[model samples]
Target chain A: MLRQLISANMNSLLRHFLILTAMLVSSGLFAQSGGEDFMRSMGKMYVVVAVIVAIFIGIVLFLIFLDKRLTKLENQIKENGKAR
Target chain B: MVKHWWKILGVALLIFAFTAGLLTPIRPGINDIQPTAVVAGQTVSLTLTGYNTDFNQEQAPKVILWKDGDHIINALGVSVLNSRQVQATFQLPTAFPLDEINELKVSTSDPANGFITALPRLRISGMEKGGEAAASAWTGTIENTDSKGGFTFPYLPNIYESVRNTFYHVALWFAMFTLFTLGVIASIRYLLTRNVMFEQRAVSYTSVGILFGILGLITGAIWAQYTWNKAWSWDIKQTMTAIVLLIYGAYFVLRISFEDSDQKARISAVYNIFAFASIIPLLYVIPRITESLHPGGQGNPAFSRGDLDNNVRMIFYPAIIGWILLGLWMAQLNFRMMKIKERLLENEY
Candidate 1:
């Protein structure tokens, strides 16, 4: 029963992907008709900026987490020295 | 020493690429204006102006007037009239009824290649009100068009050039955000471990972040003036940016407010986290919902792939990379300098 349910869900996901692909192709053709290419270019530019920001933020978050861990270890070392 | 050498090389390469990118004779595509409407059976004249690069004369522009993509009038071999001016005149079709649609394109072929540069514009405006009738009839070669079409793509270069300032302004904010995030993390660690080094790092990052935040605000203010007709408008984006600066500004005040070092660090760290929380709503959330004249304002067209053309992308992408790398270099120096300063203070006392 579980296997059957998983198969059904995968089928639905695949169908959705195909529909999205179709929509994208149709819109691209529509944009080409006007020859303006403004909207399409704007989307790409937005994604580029978004990606840059996301990566920068992700790296910073990771470094912050690392700093926290390192500080914890250093404190443990100090406590050990006091006990010794 | 090796790391220092690599850093120096990185800075030098960034400078070289940036300079080369700026100096390259790329066409900053100008803006073209379209006429909103026109009346039938009335005579109208169309006027157009050309904006060229550093070497305008080299490109002999050919202005073509079209009705629904069909060529109506063509002017070619246009030369520089006096210094930087290229004049052309065209008469609107009297036969087309009111609300007739038409387009005007100004093109210049590359002297190097046969490929033409066509900056297509719309010309759908109506005839002017009671004018000197005689002034309308004369459609001669080498004459200017009287029909008041809106400013062409020529006005766009100034706007596009302003985007370069984004590198400096946005870079400062990016660096500031990075540093402040570090400060907040260190503060949190200090709470858990009660380590002084963690506290020191937190203080250093906050200080550096504030410095960058101030620089970002200054550059953004100057840029806003030329682009928006005012240095500081009460626009949501501008206002929010100012608020972010203020929040960080208060971080300093909160630090100095308390004399005890431990108390200052603890309070300031809490404030740093709070300031960062506000950053999300102010810079990201608020700007999207509020009305703004800035590009990508609420309900306004945001910058995306569709908006940035090859002409824009040629300069914009390299600019982002160059600016980010430069920011990293500066942050590294700031972080190192901060360490030395703290060490000096420790020894002196």
Candidate 2:
């Protein structure tokens, strides 16, 4: 049963990869965009956008980690106090 | 308190770095050319694409082609396609020496947009030894670019705007080194005093250091994909850093394998010190001796012949301070939470 589930996940992953590959080929992405093209688009603000987005996601992840810890700490304190 | 002041400083510095890093524009640069190599004396059409260039502004966007260090020629029939793309037809003098120029220096200048100075080696091939440059070949003079600059990062051709990754990629390593150093120091203090609190701080700082190191690797891979045209080049520096991370990773794994808390703390602390000691040679010395694509390694200019000028240094230095302080703040928070969990577990027993 576990092996079947694992195979299903692999099959779905491969399907998504194939679809993305097909889209990339059809769109002429390789022919069109060089390395600098993405950064240069929209008056060169996209590099800034990429950077700000990366930092934003990093900070958000840290916040989530903090939040999870705080919640766990609060729960532990409450349960102990109630037992007392 | 005194501690609170530094935390405020960290936040303030980051805000400054963000504004300065993002707001500052890259100076003009030519990124690449199609038909990079050309047959001499043949009429070759070349497309030149660049960043922050204003070819449209020029009346006749001209290109100077240089053979030797001193010799220069004007490419024939230059036309501006757009702001970024310029096409030039070069009618090469049939007898120009192939050995004389492996690459022809291609320079385009606009009065308003400034110059991409020091462009050389655009790859001219297949020409015999020539007489002096024909009078027609010397169509225009190679003049210097005018600077209309306030503050800007030096425009690196291949790097382009991604030069801004200096803040995230390079500074993350700086922060990781700072945090890891603090971790090793705390671990040493724990060894001397047998204080569990010192051990806690050591573990907390190392954990946060690991997080930043991972983030550095990710940012590097992203930058490399755009700049070096690969996600992972397996460059010497990359391999060494991965190995360093793996050694520290083993420290964490070893901690989990210990049943006794004291054993976990002491042994991991020792391993942490060993990890720190090995990393200096791994990150610093070894990569210097070997070839590496990394900016500072193997005597490649500390990011291209010191192209990092005052404009970038202003934001870059502060960004390092902010990230290190921010990493420390996270470590402190984690340490306190660990204490909370520790006390609660004691109550359960």
Candidate 3:
């Protein structure tokens, strides 16, 4: 039973890794393909890009917090409601 | 009192400011002219480009030329090239008291629709004249100062369309200052009461404030490019601001370097206070006293009342409020998350 559960966890982790990698690769591809010229065409309005970045950063930070919360909850359940 | 009412309000204000700030139209003003210098008794075709002004050649809008507030050389009639550009043929008074500098202004007849109030003084540099002064068209005439116009940003000579950057650049600075103040307050509270929650809050505020400061710098550089003709003008104010940002960066470094929770809180809080204190002189005070390209510089266009007109101020003030509220909301979320992490770590130990 312990071996089977470990295999299942590893599979899920691998799947998550693949998905995140795909997302990063696709975004990098999009940026590499004419994103620079596209942004420059708009009167060098790079300020808009900066604003978008700040928003995405806030969202990413929040997601990180949520991820931590989920990990903590999962650990608690595994420990049968005990911290250590 | 962790109420979310203000957070919602802040978001709403930001939405309005963003939409209204972009949507608001600027009034008509001269953007350019050809042949900056002029000799007496010459027919010059002056081409003028306006921001959002409509010009009708049939209306015969007059281009008033003032020579150092004493002489007048009124152009004959405005020939409208399009809504944005127009031309006028000016017959220089053969002999007016010659001066080294002269100014040319243009406006339409509609009093309700005011024209560029001030500051875009198209200088007409005078050349050495050989002949005598002829009976000129620019005789004694009443210069119109009061023109009723729709709301518009002040048309500056160099800062043409980039005036829109005001919402992003100026408001971000305001927001950064507000967030930093809150951070300093939270740090003091932590030092006084030894509350871990306050320390977390202080960290969040400082982080968000630093984010704003970074945004301010980026947007300011963008504006400086078009107006000052350089990305980094080496202005004292901008250099000081960069230094202040680095100092705040050190505050975060101090926070993470200390592994002990209590020591991190105590030391980082002190550093945060010092960082905030330094911003006053570096960002605001020294910039005003020194010769910089910023608004407060000596003999700068900022001394004029044309920086933020009533229309811009309407949207700008709200933008400040929105950005600050958003920063506060982010800081609050960050604190909550860090607090949870702190609890989990404590449980582990």
Candidate 4:
């Protein structure tokens, strides 16, 4: 009897999985054939933005680092002048 | 006491008005309604939903539904299915010959009964007259028929309705802008007259602005995680907002890092000026130019989109104004408290 109940549960789970898979496939097909061009345009937009941001961030960080170094050097010079 | 008579009256009036507005439940609702879903040979279902009873509990509300200002469905068709069920669907006429905007109006309550009087409304679009053909064509264009089917922008993508966070996230920045604007004015006054009181005002506003900014970033990250599949995608807007925040955070650091009162005041004032200047572009300009997942991106129109109808604008504009005023009120109180502390210290000295 336990074996029969376990098989019944497994069969129901399999049926549910099949239904979900069918729905996904149908939706996926609709999206692929009709949605490709639009998705590509959008993907291109995101990639372009990501690249620009990466470059800008790099430059900003470089400037910040350069400023820190220059500030340190300026402080050292002021200290030297005081000593003299 | 005679000199302060106006002040006393003003306080009493303010208290009375606030209490009344709070007590008056003007929560909008739909009464009797009819909707025609099938106008112009279309097979679309129309449903109307809203709260039923008035806030005053005066009487069961009644509504009359009209098509093109013609009474098609009378108040009798407005059946209460379930006392709490707020939605009603109706079948549309096979052919609707209207050219202009179709309006839905919930009529005013019975004025004799002393209930709140107002007509809540919903609008049916003109394009619906052309039927499903027009709607399908419209959705097809918006969904983008090119590579990778459907709309490309994540914000518009069906998966990312989560982008409504744009209002809350962006609203926080607007609040920050407001507080910082106040800070700038206070800073200028401090510089002009060497008033430490003005300096304290500036500091208090900036502190609140920073708090709002941080909360904005956190909310933004939470929203980003749902749409971007990660908490921090480093989009241009995100990066810029973070940078703007850090710049102001630096102002606080500069103030605490120095012990000399004059030096702290001068340096912090200068830094605040720079922070405010950078914020305008960081929050407004660069995000538009760079690839942005945020709304108002290269392709996404920020302000004028079909999604945000006049109905949304009604609530949204008031919400922005209310939040900004609330921020200002809090900042003003902070300034007053700081002033009291300063006065106490002076007394001791």
Candidate 5:
């Protein structure tokens, strides 16, 4: 049941992530003009975007590491229970 | 639901902070002025570039060159080049009222965009030796223009809109500090009671705190890259923070090296206490004492009235609280997982 709930959460998280990426890409294309770099063009607003992305990725990776550790512990418990 | 109210509040505060931080408009400011230096006795045309300014408004901007509180020279003529640019002609007096003052402040005030001053002082050359009579050459009063009444972020020259990063980058450090404080408390408790539960809590909190410190460094580096033109300049604050992280990194290495669980917990608990003690001097005291590029160096307070006005404080305080609560929540999860693993090992025995 816990596994089911986690998968459901992951599915929604994936959907939201894809939507955010699509919006950013579309906005970047529209905001581009002349010879200036796309991110640098809009008053360097993309610097803020870059900072937010770095933070989000850091938190997500930390979560993934925690999830992997939990998975290993869960496997150890399952093996112990079957042996008994 | 009552037990989880703080969690809900954390998420809500973060959503509000993120939205408000991004959506607010920045107040108008003069970004640059061309022909930084002017001859004392000549008519010179100077071009002013502005950020978030509307120069083409119906009410034209009033430009002034100010030497001191009592002396100011109004622009002889002003022409709008575009919304963000203006050309103003100023007739300089043969001598400044104050002979020692070589730099003049340039300011522009318009009703639509409010008042903004150029960051760089204008240099004046070829001025004759002056007496009290030179004060007569200065005419006109600096106009008192009301700021456009609304909530807006203050404009900083190099920082510009990225001043919004104050919410994320600075708040991350605040959150990290809170976590490390909690970790040290747990470490002290473990030493007193010899309880493994407190040890687990300490480990969880320190791990999450380190994660946050890393995030803070990455975000700060990104901000510095554009504003300071370098991602890593070995700034004093940067060097101090790196040392703090390395000190805590050794805590984890020490934890893994000990084969006995009890010895591991007791020894790491003592090390954690020392690590926490080092933070105050490394992050706070040394940075202020040293000549540093980061704000708050050389005995100046980091969050002065100028650096964090009421407008920024609104979102900034909430961001700190939200990040702290979220970090605590992560630590709680890690602690629970550790407890479960311990239980599974006991059952195997």
Candidate 6:
């Protein structure tokens, strides 16, 4: 029963991830034509967006660093349990 | 949940800062003026361009050439070319009231949009010396127009709406500095107590501080690219901040180089103390003493009354607090994770 539930959750998560990726890709294509000029004409609102993106990336990178540390700890614990 | 009140507050303050900072309309101001210089004793038709101004409102706009408190010349005729453009004809006196050649400020006052003045654009020449009698030739009285009442950010030249980045980009540096201070405190505590917990805290805080410092640099570079027309200008503040981050970066390298935990903590604690000591001079002292393109350099002070007005201060202070709280929350989580890993390793041994 737990396995079925886990598989269902994973399927939905994958579906959502695919949808988000498609949307982003489509938006990227849409923004390709004169988007730079449009953003410039809007009094450089793009700079604010760029700054926000940089901060977001920085936070994500820190989270990834923490995750790696956790993974290392988990692997170390598994190794010790096996040895014991 | 009750213990997490600060986390909630941090998120709330950030929401408030982003909404208020980005959505607020900037005050109306003059962008440009045509025929910058004018001759004395002549009727000159001047074109005034405005930013975020509406001239065709129910109340007509007034134009004036202001020399000083006593010597003011009102436009003979005012005509609206468009919402953003106006034509005003000024009849200059044969001689300026103050001097032979006068640099007069052009002012546009509209009831809806408020008043904005161009900086010494209208130069009045052909005035003879000792024209103090011409002060009596002024005819129009300066009338005070009530500006539309609301909260608005001050309009600054060049920076324009990109000034909104202050809440994000600058707040990151403030947050980074707070984390570094906390890390230094933890380092001192570790040295005194020789406790592993405090060492964990110092490492976590310093790591998060470095992350924030990197983010601050990236955001600042993006802001400079748009405003200053360059991404990396080798600005003094930028160089000093990069050096500070590198100093802290070496702290992490120093941590991993040691196999024994006690030796590692002791050496790193001493290094952290010295690193924190260097920040004061590099960022605060040297930047102020040297000529820097950044604000707060040389004789100018950052966060001065003129640099951050009351409206910006309302959001800016909240943003700094929010970012600092968020940084603390991240560091705390990292510290807890380190403690858990250490516990697991101890149990295994």
* Local accuracy by lDDT, each model: 0.50, 0.73, 0.66, 0.50, 0.83, 0.78
Best by DockQ: 6
True contacts kept of 3: 0.05
Cα miss at B45, model 1 (Å)? 6.7
Candidate 3 wrong stretches, greater than 4 Å:
A1-84, B67-73, B97-137, B140-148, B298-305
Better of 3 and 4 by TM-score: 3
Worst 10 residues of 4 chain B by lDDT: B139-148
List-wise, what DockQ does each model earn? 0.01, 0.13, 0.11, 0.01, 0.28, 0.30
Q: What is the TM-score of each candidate against the true structure?
A: 0.59, 0.77, 0.76, 0.46, 0.87, 0.88
lDDT of 3 by residue, B138-170 (tens): 463435555545555655565544566677677
TM-score of chain B of each: 0.70, 0.82, 0.83, 0.55, 0.94, 0.95
- Residue-by-residue lDDT tens digits, candidate 6, B200-277: 999889888988887787778767766777767999889999899889878876776676878999999999999999
* Candidate 5 chain B lDDT trough over 10 residues, lowest sum: B296-305
Please write out the lDDT profile of model 2 over residues B81-153, one tens digit for every residue. Answer: 9988888887776565334445667777666566554343577776565555543454457675565477888
Write down the TM-score for model 1.
Answer: 0.59
TM-score of 2: 0.77
**How does model 1 fare in lDDT?**
0.50
Q: What is the DockQ of candidate 3?
A: 0.11
lDDT of 5 by residue, B1-349 (tens): 9999999999999998899999999888887889988888899999999888888846778899886667888998889999999999988888865565678899888878877788888988887767888888786676665675699998876777888989999999999999999999999999999999999999999999998887788778777766776778999889899899989988986876676889999999999999999999999898878887776667752553478868999999999999999999999999999999888768952
Of the candidates numbered 5 and 6, which has the greater DockQ value? 6
Q: Write the per-residue lDDT of candidate 4 for residues A1-84, one digit (tens) a residue.
A: 456446545643553354334333432443466563332332223222222232233324333433543455456556656766
Model 3 chain B — which ten-residue stretch has the worst lDDT? B110-119
Better of 4 and 6 by lDDT: 6
List the candidate 1 regions with Cα displacement exceeding 4 Å: A1-84, B26-47, B53-60, B67-83, B89-99, B102-122, B125-160, B299-349
Tell me the lDDT of model 6 at B222. Answer: 68
Better of 2 and 6 by TM-score: 6
